[model samples]
Target: VVYYFQARGHGDYDSDFSDEESGEKSVQKTKSVKEDDLLRKPFQKAKQGSVVHRRFAAEEWDREEARKRRFHLISMDAYQRHKKFVNDYILYYGGKMEDFRRSGENDKTDLDVIRENHRFLWNEDDEADMNWYKRLAKKYYDKLFKEYCIADLSRYKENKFGFRWRHEKEVISGKGQFSCGNKHCDEKEGLKSWEVNFGYVEHGEKKNALVKLRVCPECSYKLNFHHR
Candidate 1:
Protein backbone atom coordinates (compact mmCIF):
# COMPACT_ATOMS: atom_id res chain seq x y z
CA VAL A 1 0.00 0.00 0.00
CA VAL A 2 2.67 2.53 1.07
CA TYR A 3 6.46 2.39 1.43
CA TYR A 4 8.96 4.69 3.17
CA PHE A 5 12.69 4.97 2.40
CA GLN A 6 15.13 6.58 4.82
CA ALA A 7 17.55 9.08 3.32
CA ARG A 8 21.24 8.82 4.16
CA GLY A 9 21.16 11.57 6.81
CA HIS A 10 19.19 12.59 9.91
CA GLY A 11 15.68 14.15 9.48
CA ASP A 12 15.66 12.93 5.87
CA TYR A 13 13.10 10.57 4.37
CA ASP A 14 11.33 9.70 1.09
CA SER A 15 8.04 8.00 0.12
CA ASP A 16 7.12 5.47 -2.61
CA PHE A 17 3.60 4.58 -3.79
CA SER A 18 1.78 2.27 -6.27
CA ASP A 19 -1.68 2.56 -7.79
CA GLU A 20 -3.64 -0.68 -7.34
CA GLU A 21 -5.56 -0.48 -10.63
CA SER A 22 -2.97 0.79 -13.14
CA GLY A 23 -0.02 -0.55 -11.19
CA GLU A 24 1.86 2.71 -11.69
CA LYS A 25 4.87 3.37 -9.44
CA SER A 26 5.47 6.89 -8.13
CA VAL A 27 8.00 8.46 -5.83
CA GLN A 28 7.46 11.63 -3.80
CA LYS A 29 10.55 13.77 -3.47
CA THR A 30 11.35 15.04 0.02
CA LYS A 31 12.56 18.54 0.62
CA SER A 32 16.30 18.51 1.06
CA VAL A 33 17.81 20.24 4.10
CA LYS A 34 20.24 23.03 3.28
CA GLU A 35 23.80 22.88 4.62
CA ASP A 36 23.33 26.21 6.36
CA ASP A 37 20.24 24.98 8.19
CA LEU A 38 22.01 21.81 9.22
CA LEU A 39 24.98 23.86 10.46
CA ARG A 40 22.64 26.40 12.17
CA LYS A 41 24.45 29.29 10.52
CA PRO A 42 22.54 32.51 9.70
CA PHE A 43 23.49 35.66 7.89
CA GLN A 44 24.59 38.49 10.16
CA LYS A 45 23.87 42.19 9.54
CA ALA A 46 26.78 44.54 9.02
CA LYS A 47 27.84 46.22 12.25
CA GLN A 48 27.73 50.02 12.53
CA GLY A 49 31.45 50.17 13.25
CA SER A 50 32.35 48.06 10.21
CA VAL A 51 34.94 49.74 8.03
CA VAL A 52 32.96 49.38 4.83
CA HIS A 53 29.80 50.95 6.27
CA ARG A 54 31.57 53.80 8.00
CA ARG A 55 33.71 54.66 5.00
CA PHE A 56 30.77 54.71 2.60
CA ALA A 57 28.61 56.72 5.03
CA ALA A 58 31.22 59.40 5.50
CA GLU A 59 31.78 59.74 1.77
CA GLU A 60 28.07 60.06 1.12
CA TRP A 61 27.76 62.87 3.67
CA ASP A 62 30.66 64.76 2.18
CA ARG A 63 29.32 64.41 -1.33
CA GLU A 64 25.91 65.74 -0.30
CA GLU A 65 27.49 68.77 1.32
CA ALA A 66 29.55 69.46 -1.75
CA ARG A 67 26.51 69.21 -4.03
CA LYS A 68 24.54 71.60 -1.84
CA ARG A 69 27.34 74.12 -1.86
CA ARG A 70 27.64 73.92 -5.61
CA PHE A 71 23.93 74.50 -6.11
CA HIS A 72 23.92 77.43 -3.69
CA LEU A 73 26.75 79.15 -5.48
CA ILE A 74 25.23 78.61 -8.90
CA SER A 75 21.83 79.87 -7.74
CA MET A 76 23.40 82.99 -6.29
CA ASP A 77 25.13 83.70 -9.58
CA ALA A 78 21.90 83.23 -11.54
CA TYR A 79 20.01 85.45 -9.10
CA GLN A 80 22.50 88.25 -9.54
CA ARG A 81 22.06 88.20 -13.30
CA HIS A 82 18.29 88.10 -12.89
CA LYS A 83 18.41 91.04 -10.50
CA LYS A 84 20.53 93.10 -12.89
CA PHE A 85 18.12 92.42 -15.73
CA VAL A 86 15.17 93.41 -13.57
CA ASN A 87 16.81 96.62 -12.46
CA ASP A 88 17.70 97.61 -16.01
CA TYR A 89 14.14 96.88 -17.20
CA ILE A 90 12.58 98.88 -14.34
CA LEU A 91 14.84 101.86 -14.92
CA TYR A 92 14.15 101.81 -18.66
CA TYR A 93 10.41 101.88 -17.88
CA GLY A 94 10.86 104.94 -15.60
CA GLY A 95 10.34 103.01 -12.33
CA LYS A 96 12.70 103.06 -9.33
CA MET A 97 14.26 99.62 -8.61
CA GLU A 98 14.40 100.44 -4.89
CA ASP A 99 10.61 100.84 -4.80
CA PHE A 100 10.19 97.09 -5.37
CA ARG A 101 12.52 96.03 -2.57
CA ARG A 102 10.91 94.58 0.57
CA SER A 103 12.22 96.21 3.77
CA GLY A 104 14.47 94.04 5.97
CA GLU A 105 13.88 90.95 3.75
CA ASN A 106 16.30 89.00 1.61
CA ASP A 107 17.24 89.64 -2.05
CA LYS A 108 15.05 86.70 -3.00
CA THR A 109 11.90 88.65 -2.17
CA ASP A 110 13.07 91.46 -4.38
CA LEU A 111 13.53 89.00 -7.24
CA ASP A 112 10.04 87.66 -6.60
CA VAL A 113 8.48 91.14 -6.72
CA ILE A 114 10.27 91.86 -9.97
CA ARG A 115 8.96 88.58 -11.42
CA GLU A 116 5.40 89.41 -10.37
CA ASN A 117 5.67 92.78 -12.12
CA HIS A 118 7.40 91.32 -15.18
CA ARG A 119 4.49 92.10 -17.51
CA PHE A 120 4.87 95.82 -16.81
CA LEU A 121 8.50 95.90 -17.98
CA TRP A 122 8.85 93.02 -20.46
CA ASN A 123 7.71 93.20 -24.09
CA GLU A 124 7.93 90.81 -27.08
CA ASP A 125 11.44 91.93 -27.95
CA ASP A 126 12.47 91.73 -24.32
CA GLU A 127 11.33 88.10 -24.24
CA ALA A 128 13.96 87.32 -26.88
CA ASP A 129 16.52 89.23 -24.85
CA MET A 130 15.65 87.28 -21.70
CA ASN A 131 15.97 84.00 -23.60
CA TRP A 132 19.45 85.02 -24.76
CA TYR A 133 20.45 85.87 -21.23
CA LYS A 134 19.13 82.51 -19.97
CA ARG A 135 21.16 80.66 -22.59
CA LEU A 136 24.31 82.57 -21.67
CA ALA A 137 23.69 81.92 -17.96
CA LYS A 138 23.24 78.19 -18.52
CA LYS A 139 26.48 77.99 -20.51
CA TYR A 140 28.34 79.82 -17.75
CA TYR A 141 26.90 77.52 -15.10
CA ASP A 142 27.89 74.40 -17.01
CA LYS A 143 31.39 75.68 -17.56
CA LEU A 144 31.86 76.35 -13.86
CA PHE A 145 30.44 72.98 -12.84
CA LYS A 146 32.71 70.99 -15.12
CA GLU A 147 35.81 72.97 -14.23
CA TYR A 148 35.42 73.06 -10.46
CA CYS A 149 32.93 70.57 -9.05
CA ILE A 150 33.66 67.64 -11.37
CA ALA A 151 37.38 68.06 -11.85
CA ASP A 152 38.06 65.54 -9.10
CA LEU A 153 36.46 62.14 -8.46
CA SER A 154 38.85 60.93 -5.79
CA ARG A 155 36.63 62.62 -3.22
CA TYR A 156 33.63 60.40 -3.84
CA LYS A 157 34.85 57.13 -5.32
CA GLU A 158 33.28 54.81 -2.79
CA ASN A 159 29.99 56.56 -2.07
CA LYS A 160 26.79 57.70 -3.76
CA PHE A 161 28.49 61.02 -4.50
CA GLY A 162 30.56 59.41 -7.21
CA PHE A 163 27.36 59.13 -9.18
CA ARG A 164 27.21 62.93 -9.39
CA TRP A 165 30.04 63.01 -11.87
CA ARG A 166 28.25 60.54 -14.09
CA HIS A 167 24.99 62.44 -13.78
CA GLU A 168 26.67 65.73 -14.60
CA LYS A 169 28.33 64.20 -17.62
CA GLU A 170 25.03 62.85 -18.84
CA VAL A 171 23.34 66.21 -18.37
CA ILE A 172 26.12 67.98 -20.25
CA SER A 173 25.83 65.43 -23.01
CA GLY A 174 22.04 65.93 -23.16
CA LYS A 175 21.20 62.41 -22.01
CA GLY A 176 18.85 63.56 -19.21
CA GLN A 177 17.81 60.91 -16.68
CA PHE A 178 18.61 57.32 -17.52
CA SER A 179 15.86 54.76 -17.12
CA CYS A 180 15.90 52.41 -14.17
CA GLY A 181 17.31 49.09 -15.31
CA ASN A 182 14.31 47.12 -14.05
CA LYS A 183 11.66 46.48 -16.69
CA HIS A 184 8.83 45.25 -14.50
CA CYS A 185 9.11 48.00 -11.89
CA ASP A 186 7.55 51.39 -12.66
CA GLU A 187 8.33 53.03 -9.32
CA LYS A 188 10.28 56.09 -10.45
CA GLU A 189 7.47 58.59 -9.97
CA GLY A 190 9.00 61.13 -7.62
CA LEU A 191 12.31 59.53 -6.69
CA LYS A 192 15.55 61.16 -7.73
CA SER A 193 17.61 59.24 -10.23
CA TRP A 194 20.54 57.47 -8.64
CA GLU A 195 23.41 55.32 -9.76
CA VAL A 196 23.68 52.44 -7.33
CA ASN A 197 26.32 49.81 -6.84
CA PHE A 198 25.17 46.26 -6.16
CA GLY A 199 27.49 44.19 -4.04
CA TYR A 200 27.79 41.84 -1.11
CA VAL A 201 29.83 41.61 2.06
CA GLU A 202 31.57 38.46 3.15
CA HIS A 203 33.55 37.73 6.31
CA GLY A 204 33.62 41.41 7.27
CA GLU A 205 35.04 42.45 3.91
CA LYS A 206 33.07 44.12 1.17
CA LYS A 207 33.60 42.49 -2.18
CA ASN A 208 33.94 44.78 -5.17
CA ALA A 209 31.01 43.99 -7.42
CA LEU A 210 29.51 44.60 -10.84
CA VAL A 211 29.07 47.82 -12.78
CA LYS A 212 26.81 50.45 -11.29
CA LEU A 213 23.36 50.76 -12.84
CA ARG A 214 20.84 53.60 -13.04
CA VAL A 215 17.95 52.79 -10.77
CA CYS A 216 14.87 54.37 -9.24
CA PRO A 217 14.35 54.32 -5.49
CA GLU A 218 11.98 51.36 -5.45
CA CYS A 219 14.20 49.23 -7.68
CA SER A 220 17.18 50.22 -5.55
CA TYR A 221 15.43 48.85 -2.49
CA LYS A 222 15.01 45.47 -4.19
CA LEU A 223 18.58 45.41 -5.54
CA ASN A 224 20.02 46.13 -2.08
CA PHE A 225 17.85 43.31 -0.63
CA HIS A 226 16.42 45.64 1.97
CA HIS A 227 13.99 43.89 4.33
CA ARG A 228 11.98 46.91 5.42
Candidate 2:
Protein backbone atom coordinates (compact mmCIF):
# COMPACT_ATOMS: atom_id res chain seq x y z
CA VAL A 1 0.00 0.00 0.00
CA VAL A 2 1.44 3.26 -1.16
CA TYR A 3 -0.16 6.61 -0.22
CA TYR A 4 0.76 9.91 -1.90
CA PHE A 5 -0.30 12.85 0.31
CA GLN A 6 0.58 15.71 -2.06
CA ALA A 7 -1.46 16.01 -5.29
CA ARG A 8 0.51 15.95 -8.54
CA GLY A 9 -0.10 18.77 -11.06
CA HIS A 10 -1.59 17.65 -14.39
CA GLY A 11 -0.33 18.78 -17.84
CA ASP A 12 3.22 20.05 -18.44
CA TYR A 13 3.59 23.33 -20.42
CA ASP A 14 7.11 22.90 -21.91
CA SER A 15 9.27 25.74 -23.28
CA ASP A 16 7.77 25.47 -26.81
CA PHE A 17 6.66 29.03 -26.00
CA SER A 18 5.46 31.01 -28.97
CA ASP A 19 5.85 34.46 -27.35
CA GLU A 20 6.66 36.36 -24.05
CA GLU A 21 3.43 35.43 -22.23
CA SER A 22 3.89 31.71 -23.02
CA GLY A 23 7.57 31.81 -21.86
CA GLU A 24 6.58 33.34 -18.49
CA LYS A 25 3.87 30.69 -17.98
CA SER A 26 6.36 27.90 -18.75
CA VAL A 27 8.88 29.27 -16.19
CA GLN A 28 6.18 29.36 -13.49
CA LYS A 29 5.14 25.79 -14.35
CA THR A 30 8.77 24.54 -14.08
CA LYS A 31 9.18 26.18 -10.67
CA SER A 32 5.98 24.54 -9.41
CA VAL A 33 7.16 21.08 -10.63
CA LYS A 34 10.53 21.45 -8.86
CA GLU A 35 8.80 22.41 -5.54
CA ASP A 36 6.45 19.41 -5.76
CA ASP A 37 9.41 16.98 -6.32
CA LEU A 38 11.29 18.40 -3.32
CA LEU A 39 8.28 17.99 -1.00
CA ARG A 40 7.75 14.36 -2.23
CA LYS A 41 11.43 13.23 -1.83
CA PRO A 42 11.26 12.52 1.92
CA PHE A 43 8.17 10.29 1.49
CA GLN A 44 9.80 8.39 -1.42
CA LYS A 45 12.94 7.76 0.69
CA ALA A 46 10.81 6.49 3.65
CA LYS A 47 8.96 3.97 1.38
CA GLN A 48 11.89 1.46 1.38
CA GLY A 49 10.77 -1.60 3.43
CA SER A 50 10.17 -5.36 3.19
CA VAL A 51 6.62 -6.46 2.21
CA VAL A 52 4.34 -7.15 5.22
CA HIS A 53 3.47 -10.85 5.18
CA ARG A 54 0.55 -12.28 7.25
CA ARG A 55 0.64 -16.06 7.73
CA PHE A 56 -2.72 -17.87 7.02
CA ALA A 57 -4.57 -14.60 6.42
CA ALA A 58 -7.36 -16.30 4.43
CA GLU A 59 -7.68 -19.14 6.96
CA GLU A 60 -7.85 -16.63 9.82
CA TRP A 61 -10.69 -14.73 8.07
CA ASP A 62 -12.68 -17.95 7.54
CA ARG A 63 -12.22 -18.92 11.19
CA GLU A 64 -13.39 -15.45 12.30
CA GLU A 65 -16.60 -15.78 10.21
CA ALA A 66 -17.31 -19.23 11.65
CA ARG A 67 -16.74 -17.90 15.19
CA LYS A 68 -19.22 -15.05 14.58
CA ARG A 69 -21.94 -17.45 13.32
CA ARG A 70 -21.42 -19.79 16.26
CA PHE A 71 -21.66 -16.94 18.74
CA HIS A 72 -24.88 -15.68 17.10
CA LEU A 73 -26.55 -19.10 17.27
CA ILE A 74 -25.46 -19.63 20.88
CA SER A 75 -26.72 -16.20 21.92
CA MET A 76 -30.12 -16.76 20.23
CA ASP A 77 -30.58 -20.12 21.96
CA ALA A 78 -29.54 -18.65 25.30
CA TYR A 79 -32.02 -15.78 24.88
CA GLN A 80 -34.96 -18.14 24.10
CA ARG A 81 -34.12 -20.25 27.17
CA HIS A 82 -33.80 -17.12 29.26
CA LYS A 83 -37.27 -15.87 28.27
CA LYS A 84 -38.92 -19.22 29.05
CA PHE A 85 -37.10 -19.43 32.38
CA VAL A 86 -38.15 -15.89 33.28
CA ASN A 87 -41.79 -16.56 32.37
CA ASP A 88 -41.96 -19.72 34.48
CA TYR A 89 -40.15 -18.05 37.36
CA ILE A 90 -42.60 -15.13 37.36
CA LEU A 91 -45.54 -17.54 37.41
CA TYR A 92 -44.17 -19.74 40.23
CA TYR A 93 -42.26 -17.49 42.67
CA GLY A 94 -44.25 -14.24 42.05
CA GLY A 95 -41.11 -12.38 43.25
CA LYS A 96 -41.99 -12.98 46.93
CA MET A 97 -39.69 -15.67 48.27
CA GLU A 98 -36.71 -16.35 50.51
CA ASP A 99 -33.19 -16.29 48.93
CA PHE A 100 -34.37 -13.65 46.41
CA ARG A 101 -31.60 -11.42 47.74
CA ARG A 102 -27.99 -12.12 48.73
CA SER A 103 -28.20 -13.42 52.32
CA GLY A 104 -25.52 -13.96 54.95
CA GLU A 105 -25.80 -17.71 54.36
CA ASN A 106 -23.59 -17.37 51.28
CA ASP A 107 -20.02 -16.38 52.15
CA LYS A 108 -19.12 -15.19 48.62
CA THR A 109 -20.40 -12.03 46.95
CA ASP A 110 -22.63 -12.14 43.83
CA LEU A 111 -19.73 -11.18 41.54
CA ASP A 112 -17.45 -13.77 43.17
CA VAL A 113 -20.08 -16.51 42.80
CA ILE A 114 -20.78 -15.60 39.17
CA ARG A 115 -17.06 -15.58 38.35
CA GLU A 116 -16.62 -19.01 39.96
CA ASN A 117 -19.70 -20.33 38.12
CA HIS A 118 -18.17 -19.28 34.76
CA ARG A 119 -15.92 -22.33 35.13
CA PHE A 120 -18.49 -24.50 36.94
CA LEU A 121 -21.29 -23.98 34.41
CA TRP A 122 -18.99 -24.95 31.52
CA ASN A 123 -18.68 -28.47 32.96
CA GLU A 124 -22.18 -28.71 34.44
CA ASP A 125 -24.01 -28.10 31.17
CA ASP A 126 -27.33 -29.47 32.46
CA GLU A 127 -27.71 -26.85 35.19
CA ALA A 128 -25.47 -24.30 33.50
CA ASP A 129 -27.58 -21.08 33.80
CA MET A 130 -30.17 -21.97 36.46
CA ASN A 131 -28.82 -19.43 38.94
CA TRP A 132 -28.95 -16.45 36.59
CA TYR A 133 -32.38 -17.52 35.38
CA LYS A 134 -33.70 -17.55 38.96
CA ARG A 135 -32.13 -14.15 39.62
CA LEU A 136 -33.77 -12.60 36.53
CA ALA A 137 -37.17 -14.07 37.46
CA LYS A 138 -36.98 -12.52 40.89
CA LYS A 139 -35.89 -9.18 39.41
CA TYR A 140 -38.86 -9.07 36.92
CA TYR A 141 -41.35 -10.13 39.61
CA ASP A 142 -40.30 -7.24 41.81
CA LYS A 143 -40.62 -4.82 38.89
CA LEU A 144 -44.13 -6.09 38.07
CA PHE A 145 -45.24 -5.91 41.70
CA LYS A 146 -44.02 -2.36 42.14
CA GLU A 147 -45.30 -0.96 38.80
CA TYR A 148 -48.59 -2.87 38.23
CA CYS A 149 -49.99 -5.78 40.19
CA ILE A 150 -51.44 -7.34 37.01
CA ALA A 151 -49.20 -9.10 34.46
CA ASP A 152 -49.45 -8.34 30.73
CA LEU A 153 -50.16 -11.97 29.82
CA SER A 154 -51.35 -10.77 26.42
CA ARG A 155 -47.81 -9.85 25.35
CA TYR A 156 -46.77 -13.48 25.72
CA LYS A 157 -46.82 -15.40 22.39
CA GLU A 158 -48.59 -18.47 23.79
CA ASN A 159 -49.98 -19.05 20.27
CA LYS A 160 -49.67 -17.70 16.73
CA PHE A 161 -51.90 -14.81 17.81
CA GLY A 162 -50.90 -12.74 20.85
CA PHE A 163 -53.71 -12.66 23.42
CA ARG A 164 -56.71 -10.62 22.33
CA TRP A 165 -58.99 -10.31 25.33
CA ARG A 166 -62.79 -9.95 25.13
CA HIS A 167 -65.22 -9.38 28.00
CA GLU A 168 -68.24 -11.69 28.45
CA LYS A 169 -70.94 -8.99 28.32
CA GLU A 170 -71.36 -9.42 24.53
CA VAL A 171 -71.83 -13.17 23.94
CA ILE A 172 -75.44 -14.48 24.29
CA SER A 173 -76.36 -18.11 24.96
CA GLY A 174 -78.58 -20.39 27.07
CA LYS A 175 -77.62 -22.65 30.01
CA GLY A 176 -75.58 -25.81 29.07
CA GLN A 177 -75.05 -24.33 25.60
CA PHE A 178 -71.51 -22.90 26.17
CA SER A 179 -68.32 -24.64 27.28
CA CYS A 180 -64.68 -23.69 27.64
CA GLY A 181 -63.08 -23.29 24.20
CA ASN A 182 -59.50 -23.79 25.40
CA LYS A 183 -58.08 -27.26 24.71
CA HIS A 184 -56.04 -27.10 27.95
CA CYS A 185 -59.06 -26.13 30.08
CA ASP A 186 -62.07 -28.36 30.93
CA GLU A 187 -64.75 -25.82 31.89
CA LYS A 188 -68.13 -27.36 30.94
CA GLU A 189 -70.46 -25.17 32.98
CA GLY A 190 -72.51 -22.00 32.34
CA LEU A 191 -70.73 -19.87 29.67
CA LYS A 192 -71.38 -17.60 26.69
CA SER A 193 -71.01 -18.77 23.08
CA TRP A 194 -67.82 -17.46 21.41
CA GLU A 195 -66.17 -17.91 18.03
CA VAL A 196 -62.67 -18.73 16.83
CA ASN A 197 -61.44 -17.58 13.39
CA PHE A 198 -58.47 -19.17 11.67
CA GLY A 199 -57.06 -19.85 8.23
CA TYR A 200 -57.31 -23.23 6.49
CA VAL A 201 -55.87 -24.61 3.26
CA GLU A 202 -57.97 -26.59 0.75
CA HIS A 203 -56.30 -28.12 -2.32
CA GLY A 204 -53.29 -25.93 -1.75
CA GLU A 205 -55.44 -22.81 -1.64
CA LYS A 206 -55.65 -20.84 1.59
CA LYS A 207 -59.11 -19.96 2.90
CA ASN A 208 -60.71 -18.41 5.96
CA ALA A 209 -62.74 -20.42 8.46
CA LEU A 210 -64.66 -19.82 11.70
CA VAL A 211 -65.72 -22.13 14.52
CA LYS A 212 -68.31 -21.58 17.26
CA LEU A 213 -66.89 -21.96 20.76
CA ARG A 214 -67.62 -21.35 24.43
CA VAL A 215 -64.80 -19.90 26.51
CA CYS A 216 -64.77 -20.31 30.27
CA PRO A 217 -63.56 -17.58 32.63
CA GLU A 218 -60.04 -18.94 33.21
CA CYS A 219 -59.42 -19.99 29.59
CA SER A 220 -60.86 -16.76 28.23
CA TYR A 221 -58.57 -14.80 30.47
CA LYS A 222 -55.48 -16.81 29.49
CA LEU A 223 -55.89 -18.31 26.01
CA ASN A 224 -55.61 -16.30 22.80
CA PHE A 225 -58.72 -15.49 20.72
CA HIS A 226 -57.31 -15.79 17.18
CA HIS A 227 -54.19 -15.47 15.03
CA ARG A 228 -52.68 -12.06 14.59
In terms of lDDT, the best-performing candidate is: 2
lDDT of 2 by residue, 138-169 (tens): 33333321110111234335554311122232
Number of clashes recorded per candidate: 0, 0
Model 1, span 137-211: residue lDDT tens: 333333432211111123222332222223355445433234343434334354344334434443354544323
**How many clashes does the backbone of model 1 have?**
0
Clash pairs for candidate 1: none
In Å, residue 180's CA in model 1 sits off its true spot by 2.5
